[model samples]
Structures are given as C-alpha cells and as structure tokens.
Target: MPLLDAARAVRENAHAPYSRFKVGAALRTTTGAVFSGCNVENVAYPEGTCAEAGAIAAMVAAGETRIAEVAVIADSPSPVPPCGGCRQKLAEFADGDVVVTMATTAGQSATLTVAELLPGRFAADHMGNG
Candidate 1:
C-alpha cells in the first residue's frame, strides 16, 4: 500500500480525546516490513504517546529496527511535524537521511529527512561519553 494510504488507515485507530488531535504514522523498514500506529492520549497528558513513537514501539516489539521510510498524518490544515521527542526517538532506528512524510486531512503533504527535522541530535553514541 502507498504510504499515504497506510497513514490514513492508521489514523482511523487513533485514541485521542484530550486535545482531540488525532495522528497516525506508518513506517516501512529496510526489511520490507510495514508497521503502523496511531496516537494514544491519556488524561494525565504527559503519559500520551505520539503516533511516531507508537509505530517505533511496534517495530521494536516485532524485533525489527532500521526504518527506511515513514509517513505521518493529521487532521489539520497544516502538515503536522513529529514532536521533538518523536524526532529523537526516530534517530534511534533511522539514518539521518531517512524519508519522513507529513500529510494533512485536506491532502496537503510535505517530505523531509530525519536530519532536517532534528539537527544536532544526540544518539546512542553520546550515552558513553567519558
């Protein structure tokens, strides 16, 4: 399925209530596996997880890493960029040039690279700083 179609289908499963901001994400791994996820919110706010994180979690749960492409969808006029936390999380499994596409309910869309979304990101290598 096309990335947009996957994102739209995943969007239907969003469990958002507090902000009423639903989001969906689909990721295609280098191994040719497609994983999808939707935003899940909590009344506690900070416990909420973004769609991108959900997708990554699913991928990890399935024992797969290294994403090649990712698409995100939101029901807003402007394309929704992934949150800072999500961006950082993406860097853990995707290369700096990984393709990230964002889409709006009205069909507007934009594509960017992981590096473009999160510049100067700290990754696993930074954890061992001596």
Candidate 2:
C-alpha cells in the first residue's frame, strides 16, 4: 500500500548513528490522513525514540488518533518488528484489529493485526475507560 511506500521512503532519513539501524513508520489515521516518522538516535543512549512513536506524536499533534493502519520499515535480514515498547505505544491508538505491516528493506513484509502483535493489551477497558 501507499503507506508502506511512505514508510520505506522515510527510512532513509533515520538518524541512527549509534546502532546504525534505521527504522521508519507511517501511521494512517481514521480520518484518512497519513503521517510518517524516522527513528532518531541520541548519544545519550536508551532515550532514543522509535519511528512509530514519532509518527504517533505527529498524528496526535495534528489532533488525530485511532490509527486504522500502520507500516514500519527497516533494513534487516528479516522484517523488523517494533520493539515491545512500540507495540504497546501502537496499541494505545490502534485497536486489536488494526493492521500492522512490518517490512524489510529487501521489500519482504509481514502483515498482522495489533492484537496479533500484542495480545492482552493494556488498554482503556483495563483502565475502566468504558
């Protein structure tokens, strides 16, 4: 999809000097707007932001939430899945059914729902948001 293409394009802009592992994410809001982000690494260590988090920040800054779809791209031997933290972050804005497309620079990909990536999510119902 176009969102996967966008994520692939943004992967080139990642500032990953430390790990040299660039990652990019594209998030599609329920309103049909697409936002993209590239990972930014810091010398300080461990505080670097994930591409998914950055994209979510941009989406929220634009007053959009409820990610209907997500795409993440990285140059890895296999499709790079988001870290545990990112999966949770994604779950915060996306439901169990939201698609999460993980891709490699080689164009290989795997698509799974958010629940498939992170089952038993720590979401609103657990917090009584219902």
Candidate 3:
C-alpha cells in the first residue's frame, strides 16, 4: 500500500476528542516491516501522544529499532510537523537523512529529513553530565 494510503487508514483510528485534530503515522522499519499508529489524546493536553511517537512505540514493542521511512498525515491545510519530543524520539531510530513525509487531509504534502526537522538533536550519548 502507498504511504499516503497507510497514513490515511491509520488516521481514521485516531482517538482525538479535545483537539479534534487527528493524526496518523506509518513507519517502515529496517526489518521490512511497517508499523502504524494514531494520535491518542487525553483530557490533559500534555498527556496526548503524537502519531509518530505511537508508531515508534509500536515498532519498539515489536523489537524493531531502526526506521527507514516515516509518513505522517493530519487533517489540516498544511503539513504538520512533528513536535519537539517526537523529533527527539525520531532521532533515536532514524538518522538525519531518513525520509520524513508529511501530508494533509486536503492532499497537501511535504518531505523533510529528521535532521532538517530537529537540528543538533541531543541523543542518549549526550545524556548525563554537564
């Protein structure tokens, strides 16, 4: 299935209520497996999970640590960029040049790299210490 089709299909399962902003993400892993996730919102705004995060969680749960491609879709006029936390999480599994595709409900689309989305990201290696 096309990336867009996978994203659109997953978007339908989004559990968004407060924001009514549904998002979906499909990630292709280095193991040739595709994992899909949908945004799950909570009453507490900060507790909500982004689509990309969910997809990564699913991949990790399945023991897949590397991502080759990721496609995110939302019901917006323009492409929705991943949040800071999601960007950091993505850097853990995907390198700077990993394909990052964004799409909107109206068919608008854009592509970028993890590095372009989050420049100078601090990874686990940068943890602990001054």
Per-model RMSD to reference:
1.5, 1.1, 2.0
lDDT of 2: 0.92
Kindly report which residue stretches of model 3 are placed more than 4 angstroms away from their true locations once superposed. Answer: 128-130
For model 1, name the residue pairs that clash: none
Cα lDDT of model 3 by residue, 1-130, tens digit: 9866888899999999888999999999987889989999999877988999999999999989999999999989899988899999999999899989999989899999999999998977677642
Please estimate how well model 3 matches the true structure, expressed as its whole-model Cα lDDT: 0.91
TM-scores of all predicted structures: 0.95, 0.95, 0.94
32-67 per-residue lDDT for model 2 (tens digits): 999999999999988899999999999999999889
Positional deviation of 89 in candidate 2, in angstroms? 1.0
Model 1 spans with C-alpha error above 4 angstroms? none
Which residue pairs in model 3 clash with each other?
Answer: none
lDDT tens digits, residue span 8-127, model 1: 999998999888889999999999899999999999978988999999999999999999999999999899999999999998899999999999989999999999999999976678
lDDT of each: 0.93, 0.92, 0.91
